[model samples]
Target chain A: MTRMNERLKKIIIIVVGLLMILLMAISFGGRERITAVESQLGSFIAPVQRFFSQIGNFMDEKTEPIINVLNYKSLNESLAKENEMLKAQVVSLTMAQKDFEELNDLKQSLHYVERSDQDNYISCSVIAKDIGNWFNMFTIDAGTEQGVTKNSTVINGNGLVGLVYEVGSNWSKVISIIDHKSSVGFEMLRVTDDYDGILSGTTNYELVGELYDTQANVHVNDYIVTSGLGMYPKGILIGQIYELVDDRDLFLKQIKVKPAVDFKKLNKVMVIPYDEYEEEITTYLP
Target chain B: MNKIFVFLMAIANFILMSTLFQQFRVYGVLANLCIVFSIIFAILFSEQHGYIFAIVSGLLQDTFLGKVLFVNTIIYIILIYVTVRIEKIMFKGNDLTPIFLISMATIAYHLIFFVFMFLLQSTIPIHQLLMHVIIEVILNSVIGLFIYRVVFKNVFGYKLGDYNA
Candidate 1:
């Protein structure tokens, strides 16, 4: 009799659990309804995650020799050699960039400069990461207290990072550009024939852009930047066109762009506080 | 008291895994400590406690990430109790049962999650995630083996939940 009762209880649990799963699955396509609950919980959990991050970082530094020697000895040597090569390349690139700026100044009046002043950005540190590598969403230490709000543009030193998705009192969730849902308007710097496209992220960790016309003359290594007409500030570097797929026959032709920001190594970001420009741009976004 | 301890431990594990252990990622996969704890909890206590904690931990994860809501909870449903049920039938009372179940549970839970999320129109690189899942399985297996001896069997032990070790 007791065995039968236990079995019945198990069956009841399985059935109820299935019903709950079905309800959640049906609502999967909609906006997550746990935003408020998450914000409250994030306020509680973020500091805990931050504390553990510090400890983990400490352990990583102290035991680096043991782990590195055991596993990354050869990997370290290769990385060192690669670092030297990259440093030299950077030096050469810097000189070339200086010359390019001069040429651009002479050729066109579109002198682009980054608005990275202390007043323009509220600097924040990453406190917690998403559960897995499936998506690049993360939580930052800044929140509504620091003037961060939902949909604010986030950028690191390199270039475009992501945008604020959710915000609490002391923390905010950032969704990186590599997410399939993210879309940013972009314009080609070299090909200034009014040839602009919207850059969107894909599942394969690639940023892709589709031009309005199928036969637009675009080439590999062409520079792309955020169009002044959208959420992101104008003239910020997006990436170089990596490849132009053979989608000429398709109605919406697409081109592959490598993102300027290295999503893998992102640690710190600066959130542009919501201002008149972003407020206006959000209205134009579909 | 024991239940509260388990709950606190589960929360702590979730916090640490998503934050601190992110640095220890290999192939961009962090070791899921909550899944490990849920497996241990289910085995030591009952299938009910295991799945219950699984859902709780999964909900906690949902708070951080914007994905299919309760997908983690739903995925975890099959993890704890089912693994425990399998252990009861196939390898009951074996000392290595926890280790095997933890590893299998972690891998299965993630694989099932990715598939379920994919079916929901979320695009995932199955090939790339598969590699990380394998790496995570091996990584969590080693971690489970270590914790089984040094932590689970001694520190918390089965006795806390009134189960014989």
Candidate 2:
């Protein structure tokens, strides 16, 4: 009986091991696509994740004030003395603000903001994020509850963050532009005549892109903004060209970009409420 | 009672690491608490317990963030197996044994993850990725030292030599 049981255990272990490998191959190897039904079943985890995410957010919220108090405890004594020291500094800061506004105007940012119409944006907090060192994916607190749909353009004060990919009742998953699958259409705002390019994120958390034509003069720190061809709103700043690399494609000038938004410290974002999509219809030429 | 405590602690750790830890980065690399827990389990518990935790935690991670399924699951399984194998052959009853194993596991887990990611997306730079994996390994190892001491030695009262084969 003992020998028979031992044989049976070994066989069972072998079968299970094979099944695990098969599952891994199917998923990671991308051999067979996960069916929609299976995907929907997988999404059943959303609510549970949302619950834990809320618990985490609650803890953070409760802890932030205490932390702030501890940090500012020493600062409190120096406040009055610092206030006297900072009075003249305020005038310099005001002048700096004016200079910043002038710079913004030079970039035609006001025009971009006017065209983009920020009124329809829904404010949301990040409740959870991708469970890895890669901050390429995350979840937001607002979802269908706040009328957030898939593919909404997500942004923060820094620049374009990413787009919503999946949505549930109260939460949604956001795939940042740094993810390998993400791509964005952008134009150089510094070049008024504007060179265009398509930007894609790499596994190394960097954005690499190619301009439509190499004729346009590209410089370091020249800002790139969305071209507004797709779901993205017009002129949303993506990032600045960090370096000009060798063009791999004959049709485009390859370049590297430094994304404006800090992917790691993202806490809040605004999702533009737009569901614009093009569906072309055709008929057989009878 | 210990099993229940471990299960709850795992859940709490998962939630904290996935969400709250984003705001608190150490040297631009987020500490992977899931990998840390699974390594500890593989070193301290029986194989069955270690395997179960690995799968459960791996599935949660995949379901929430994974575009392709079973990637995290397979990685966790690989890490656990490596951890178990290392534990059997290493010198036990040392203060640094768990820390050393955790560091090895961290490196192995990330190396495998990067290898798979490179297969999926061929654009990843090898040297740049190695730097990232190294940073994470060092960060996780430093954290594992304190965490193991508290959770293993003080809380669980686990001996320095608790490897079950």
Candidate 3:
């Protein structure tokens, strides 16, 4: 009986081990499917995310006043500067709105192309940071309840922040461009023309890009923007080229960029709820 | 009771490490206090207990990171096994040995982690990698010493001779 029990225990352990291995393999192999499942799961847990976000907001409310009280003079000066900036932004936006109205005629002429580019965006505040060391992910106070979904492009007022990798009912996880696995299609906005490239993150807090051999005419301080790829909309500011390193052996040039958005100080973000050129970009990739 | 307490403490330690300690990055190198604790715990406890703690710790790490699921489990298990085996041989409860062991283990863990990351085609620079290892070693050792004094000595009533006897 003892020997039989020992054999049964061994069998159970082996079965469990095999099951674990199989699960891991499936998780890695069917990554897209797993991601889809995670997004689906997000819809179910949106309310929980909302509750957490509310808690975070409550904490912030309680802490902010105390912090301000301790440093009132500095806080006042900072608030005044921020107010001035906000006024300037409002003025620019008002002018842009007017220009948008005037360009309605031109827009009608390019209706077919412009129609697809139109999208709805929702703004949400950062609720929490994801608990991890490897990936730079954060949870935001928006979810499927607010129409946020997986693969949604998230950005701050300044520039791109990241993309929604996973979403819960009221919260979503954003995989920042700083994450090692993240890749973005980018372009250089020069005075004359736009050149395309692929942006990747490095160990340092810098976004770097590898330009195509033909369109390698990039210089330091050149503005980088998201290419009008299916994943991201066109003309969105990415960063400025800080350095250009030439790889003689590979005949390739690497452009280091300082992202316009400071992720460390991120408070609120806008989620582009729809993919503008999804079909076109998917067709281009394998 | 002891098992439940240890498990809860490990979870709490993980939560604090991920959320609180993350804000205190020095020149882009963060302290891995959890890893240090795992090592110390494995060294102080029985081999079976160490193995169990390692698995729990790894699962806690995986849940937080959302990537590299089994990597932590496998690594921690190996680390605990090695630490326990070394403890059995050396059989000492000295201050210097714990510090040295922690420093070595911390460096080893970072190196092994870097190699795995490299295999996965991560883009971490060599200089930053070295800096991370050094910083983690120093921080973990300092923190390990304090934990040893407080938890093992004061709370648990563990002495250097506990292992041998």
Candidate 4:
């Protein structure tokens, strides 16, 4: 009788676990806001994560020179080899700078505004990163208290990083563009015409894009930016196309892209509060 | 008292894994200290205690990540259950038990997580998942052995492989 009771208890536990999994699977699509309990728990844990993160950074900074010194012979050889290549690269870069300046002047005259220029950015330090590689997500120190809200665009100096999905009092969870579940509306930044496309992340931490027009003229090294049709704002640099995929469908022009942000090294990010630019962003549509 | 200490350590390990251990990724996969801790704690303590630790740690992870809730809880529960079952068959205090169990548990964890994501219609490359499991198994085994010995020694007041002593 006692053994039967134990078996019944095990069955009950299994049923409860299955129910929870089923509920989570059903609600997987729409992750608008996290529960208050989750938010509070995250808020409680953020400070401790921040403390440990800082200590890790401090230890890395202190040990880097020692590591460098230990590898001084190899480092010196590499530096000498790089110096020769840099000398030739600098001359070409100087020439390119002249052309860049001309383009900048022309852009300024045309009153071309960049999405990043809008001043609703709240800078925050990364406290914790997603423990698993399945999702490229992180928690930042800034939250609703610091003007960060759900669906806000997160960017580093390089470019579009991700979007904030959950917010607490002083912390927010950011899902990066490289996460498999994340998708962005992007457009090719061509001089003649722009072709809209949808870019989604892959499990291998890479971006893949599909253009709406099958006959679009796309080539390697073409620049891609956010199309302002989704959670991200307009004109934010997403990445550049690297390789084109041969798809048998013939209706979608698919290509592989290299992301602008180095997700592995993310430390600090600026959040563009979605509500602050809601009105201005809506004007971009239609 | 032991349960409370173990619970606190779980939280501390979670913070360390998501913060410090994140920097030391080998081939884009970091060793999940929470998994290692849960497996080792389950082996050291009673099966009932193991389930309790799994629930707490798993909930803490899902709460902190703010993703599909209870995903980790379900995975960890399965892991603890499997570990407890295997413990009954093998030498309970054997040193190789945890190394083997952790390796298997890590693979199971990823496979279960992949299944969950696939059910949600997330696209995960099979090769990428394989690579993640392979690297994580190696990492978790090495790290899990160390954590196992530490917990075993501290809780039982003797080193592993010296159960009679």
Question: Which candidate's TM-score is highest?
Answer: 4
Across B26-141, the per-residue lDDT of candidate 3 in tens digits comes to 66566666567777766665555556666776765543344444556656665765676577676445777678778877776766666655655653666745655677678778
After best superposition, candidate 4 residue A66: deviation in angstroms? 6.5
Name the candidate that leads on lDDT.
Answer: 4
What are the per-residue Cα lDDT tens digits for candidate 2 across A6-115?
57856765676567556655654222223554346444545565566566666767877887887686788689777886898799879989998898797795465332
lDDT to native, each model: 0.72, 0.70, 0.66, 0.81
Show model 1 residue runs off by greater than 4 Å: A1-37, A55-120, A202-205, A228-233, A248-254, A273-286, B92-100, B151-165
Q: What is the C-alpha DockQ of each candidate?
A: 0.50, 0.34, 0.20, 0.61
RMSD of each: 6.5, 8.9, 6.3, 4.8
Q: Over the stretch A35-71, how does candidate 1's per-residue lDDT look in tens digits?
A: 5666678788878877876676667678777856766
Least well predicted 10-residue stretch by lDDT in candidate 1 chain A? A277-286
Interface RMSD of 3: 4.8
Looking at model 1, the pairs that clash are none
User: What lDDT score is found at residue A45 in candidate 3?
Assistant: 39
RMSD in angstroms, candidate 2? 8.9
Where in model 3 is the C-alpha error above 4 Å?
Answer: A1-25, A29-103, A106-119, A122-133, A139-146, A167-172, A213-217, A273-286, B118-128, B155-165
Q: Deviation in angstroms for B161 in model 2?
A: 9.6
Sequence-dependent TM-score of model 3: 0.73
